[model samples]
Target: MDELTEFIQSNPDPRELKRALAVQMVLQEYTYFAIRDVLQVSVGFISKWKQAYEIQGVAGLALEHQGSVGYLDNEQRQAVIDWLKAKNYWNLNELQQHLEAVYDVVFASKQSYYELFSAAGISWKKTQKRNPKADPQAVERKKQEITDWLEQHRHQISSGELVVFFQDECHLLWGDLCGYVWGKTSERIEVPMSNERQKQTYYGAFNILSHKFFVQAFEQGNSEFTIAFLQALLAECPESRIALIWDGASYHRSQAVKDYLASVNQGLQESEWRITCIRFAPNDPRQNPVEDIWLQAKRFIREFYHLCQSFSTVKWLFEFVTHRQTFNFPKASMYGLFS
Candidate 1:
């Protein structure tokens, strides 16, 4: 008897019998069309069974379709899933180490572990930075404080007398921001990298109500530079009282900045146009809308980095790009602050 007929007689499974019958017909020199006509099966079905049998032998004709056995059994897989759920982050190397340590099983290759994770419905992704010392309670309280402050100054804000701004600093590098791009299949697309290692430091603020953006490039970000930028921002908004909200950077909290703020606030109070400085909760860059603005700016710069040659050119291009772009502050505003 042929392999298919022998398998069917030995197995006695209905599904196996069906698959064996199809393979048997094919082995008997029956064309796919003839097999379909005789067995009342589709040509595709007959072809699939024939192909499976030819490639995988009688095992492929088994009634149940069990995928290749994994390194971990069902119980071990469940255990792995439970372990993953308990942890915040894990790399493939760490997972391999854990499997070797706990289960006494070692994955021969990274691909084996990757396949295991994938089969377990786990995916690799970028991890967000979270400060371990950041207090959730303090973050919530700060959010409420900001919300209350906005509510208190609703009239001044609505009348355009007082303006609120979220400010932050970012360092823009002179290298190509490497990311996925459309290219011909199986062909590598290269982005030119700059030999210049120079970077541009920028201080930017986003107007809360007007969706206005104010930015200044500096050689470095420190107390002196921050003070100068604040002075320029204040000068730009001569008509209105400004409420500047920024992160708790060391330069922002320096003695020089304090003295400058004291002098500026004293002068503004005298002139009836106040410039109030408020600090966002520590380690909470997410609370500042200006962070999103910087991210958008860097993304644009990276996408078009090949166009610029020098740091000066990059700076000019950055200013030109950012100056024309109007940020949607309301869309990027934090939950309790602008809601």
Candidate 2:
């Protein structure tokens, strides 16, 4: 056995010397038998340690190193976290590219990036929701308006002699009828549809109290469609006097809708088919039960309407969703802020 190799293997602190010896052995092109005898180890053991050092560098040569790949340094990884917080949005590949450009470190795989983001508690995709600009004060004002009017009619309501209906416009799109599939990491494929038809939009309404629902197809969200929805809602409901709670949307506040309500009120004075509309606070969809209905109804469609790929499929899916939502109304209406 050689003096240097024996010294490397036996010294009090031999980690650095072990790396130096492994590198020297490779550079000298020493035979496995010679290296083993000098290091006081089996030929296979010397070969294994040497190969590990060659592949993993000096850090890999230490006996206590355990030979596991270390994560990126704290500062380097913290840079990524700071970038994510600053941007507020990032895809897997985008983050990888940024990390590589700034830190010059390559992640092992896409799965590693996913693991990092998952561990840090970040959502990989956007969620559909009401606009952030929606006015909360307006919503509360409308809710108070409804509460005030309901108090005035509390006696009739308790008698079950008059029905209060909350109506709003809901648009149904052909492409919105599909169920959620397990999407691939970087690619999304759209399956072909068996039923092909022109895209169709619909205007629908549901009574907040009765759960009575009605929907009709339309070409646009104009005043005509809005009035048509109101008419359908009235037809579906047999109540003598129906009060409506709606948003302060342009169409709902338009002259056409106002005239229609006034006309209904005048004619119903004898049979009293009175209709009162309350515009909810400006941006608050939270207080409106109808918005909740739309959210849950859409979830049901997206989660299970797998075969839907066209207008007809969408219509059928809507029908199924409305049925499910209406039949489950009592349980569904139990939702609240606390819930």
Write down the TM-score of every candidate: 0.64, 0.62
Those runs of model 1 whose alpha carbons end farther than 4 Å from true positions after fitting are 1-89, 92-121, 180-190, 194-197, 267-273, 308-313, 329-331, 335-339
- Please give the lDDT score for candidate 2: 0.60
Quote the lDDT for 87 in model 1.
77
lDDT of 1 by residue, 1-339 (tens): 366666777856554576688888788888888876676556666777778788889887664433332267879977887787677766775675466435545555678777767766678765668888788889889988987888888778778788788788888877635454566889886655555466788888877776778888898999999999988887887888888888889999999998887877774453354678888789867778777777676677667756755666667777876753577655455533431
Model 1: residue 37 alpha-carbon error in angstroms: 58
**CA lDDT of each prediction against the hidden true structure:** 0.73, 0.60
Task: Assess the local accuracy of residue 224 in candidate 1 as a C-alpha lDDT between 0 and 100.
Answer: 96
The sequence of per-residue lDDT tens digits that candidate 2 reaches over residues 51-138 is 7666776544554533433357888777677667677666775665455434534566777787668656775665767877877776
